[model samples]
Target: MEVFLSICLGLGLSASSGFRVFLPMLIANIAAMSGWISPAESFAWLATWPAFFALLTATIAEIGGYYVPFIDNLLDTIATPAAIIAGTLLSTSFIQIDNPVLQWGLGLILGGGTAGMVQVGTGLLRLLSSKTTAGLGNPVVSTAENVASFGLSGLAIFLPIIAMVLVVLLILWLFRKIANLRKTK
Candidate 1:
């Protein structure tokens, strides 16, 4: 049960990373520093002051970049891969499995996969919004993504089950939306 909860929390955080790579890491660092959460032994550095400040800087830059006009689209290309790496690290930090191989394997597969899928969906949404609204709606989308990343990261830390359920539902909804878009095209 503990392991299950850990996986849920990790995946939830990973999904949050998909929306914004650095936000989830910043939240986790703060949580760990405040004694609200404990990362794996190897990830103990995540709770340190240097890590906090670095993540803070990255988060601010990433969020601000998304508010820019053409820069947001350019950032998405780089963010996709960065989000996957962040997701894998976030998930791996929570996993308590005895075997390093199994832990990293699951982290790479589930964590990376979840983050990648969400990132793809968000990129698509941004593209559609850019096309339909002449890029005027992008700031709104960026704001929503930021909010979702923060909310999901908090929920993942405090309520793993609920966060996991929300992530699952979000993935399902994204898949359905993509399918519908395919049908139209």
Candidate 2:
């Protein structure tokens, strides 16, 4: 059950990564440093000050990038793989599986897949927003994504089960949004 909760937290964070890749990692870093959670042995560096600062910097940059006009679109192209990689790392860190191969395999599949799917959904949403509003609506979308990343990270740490439920709901919403976007195109 403990392991299950950790995976739940990881998956929740993974979903948040789709919105902002580094914010989830920064949250995990803080959680580790504060003794709220323990990362796997290999990921112990996450509890250190250097990792915290680095993730903080990256988080700030990522958030700021999304508020930029044309750059936000370019960032989406970069965010897909970055979100997958960050999601895999975040999930693998909390998971305590003994087997190296199995741990990473599950992280890559479940965590990466969750983040990648949501990243694509968000990218599509941004594209639709840009098309409909001529890029004026992107900042609003960016703000919402920022709020989601922060909210989900908080829930993932403090309420793993609730976080998982939100992740599910968010994914379902993303699917509906994607379908609607497709209809318009």
Candidate 3:
């Protein structure tokens, strides 16, 4: 049960990374420091003050970058892969499987995959918004993503089961919407 919860938390936080790469890391650092969550032995560095401040700075820069018009799209090109790496790291941090091979396998497959899917969805959404609104609507989308990253990170730490449910629902909704868009095209 404890292991299950850890995976759920990891995946949930990983998915949140899709929206904003550093937000989940910041959340995890705070959680680890506050005793809300415990990282694996290999990831203990994340709980340090330096890591906390570094992630805080990165989080601010990432959020601000998304608010820039054309820069947001350009950043997406970079952020997608970064999010996957961050997601995998986030998952491995909380998960405690004994086998290193199995742990990293699950982290890359589940955590990285979830973050990639969500990042793709958001990138597409941002593209659509940019097209429809001449990039004027991107800040709103950026704001929403920021809120989502923060909310999902908190939920992932404190209520992982609920966060996983939300992630599933979000994926389903994205699939349905994509299918509908395809049908129209």
Candidate 4:
């Protein structure tokens, strides 16, 4: 049950990574630091006070940076790697694994892959918003992203399966909207 829960949690965190890369990691860092969740021995580094502080600082900076008009788009360019790394870390940290290979493989496929997919989708959304809305509607998009990231992170930490379902639904909805737009064009 613990293993299943942890995997679900990892998947949830990975999905949250699609929205904002660091938000879920920051949440996990705080949770682990506060002893709400216990990570595996290999991931004990995340529990350190220094790591927590660093992640907190990074999280705040990332949030603040996203509110800047053109700067937000620039940040998205770099956020891809951040999202993937954060996804892998969050997913791999909680799972107990004796073999390094298995842990890494799962982390790459589930964590990194999920984050990358979400990040790509979000980048496209921002691009389309910027093109059609002239960046005027970016704040609304940003706000939604922030909320989704925060809410999904919390859900991932607590109830992962539901988070996964939400991620699936979100992806399908986005895909359908995009297809409809292409057809209209």
lDDT of model 2, residue 118: 86
Candidates 1 and 4 compared: the better one by TM-score is 1
**Highest lDDT, which number?**
1
**lDDT by residue for model 2 (22-106), tens:** 9999999998899998999999998999998999899889999999988999999999999999899988888778898988988
Query: How many pairs in model 4 have backbone atoms within 3 A of each other, for residues 3 or more apart or on separate chains, i.e. clashes?
Result: 0
Cα lDDT tens digits, model 1, 25-107, are 99999999999988999999999999999999999999999999989999999999999999999999997787999999999
Identify the superior model by lDDT, candidate 1 or candidate 4: 1
Q: List candidate 3 stretches off by more than 4 Å.
A: none
- How does model 4 fare in lDDT? 0.83
Q: Sorted by lDDT, highest first, which candidate order results?
A: 1, 3, 2, 4
Pairs of residues at least 3 apart in sequence or in different chains that clash in candidate 1: none
lDDT of all predictions:
0.95, 0.91, 0.94, 0.83
lDDT of 3 by residue, 83-140 (tens): 9999999998888799999999999988998898899999999999999999999999
Q: What range of 10 consecutive residues in model 4 has the weakest lDDT sum?
A: 91-100
> Which of 2 and 4 is the better model by lDDT?
2
Between candidates 3 and 4, the lDDT winner: 3
Instruction: State how far residue 184 of model 1 sits from its true place (Å).
Output: 1.3
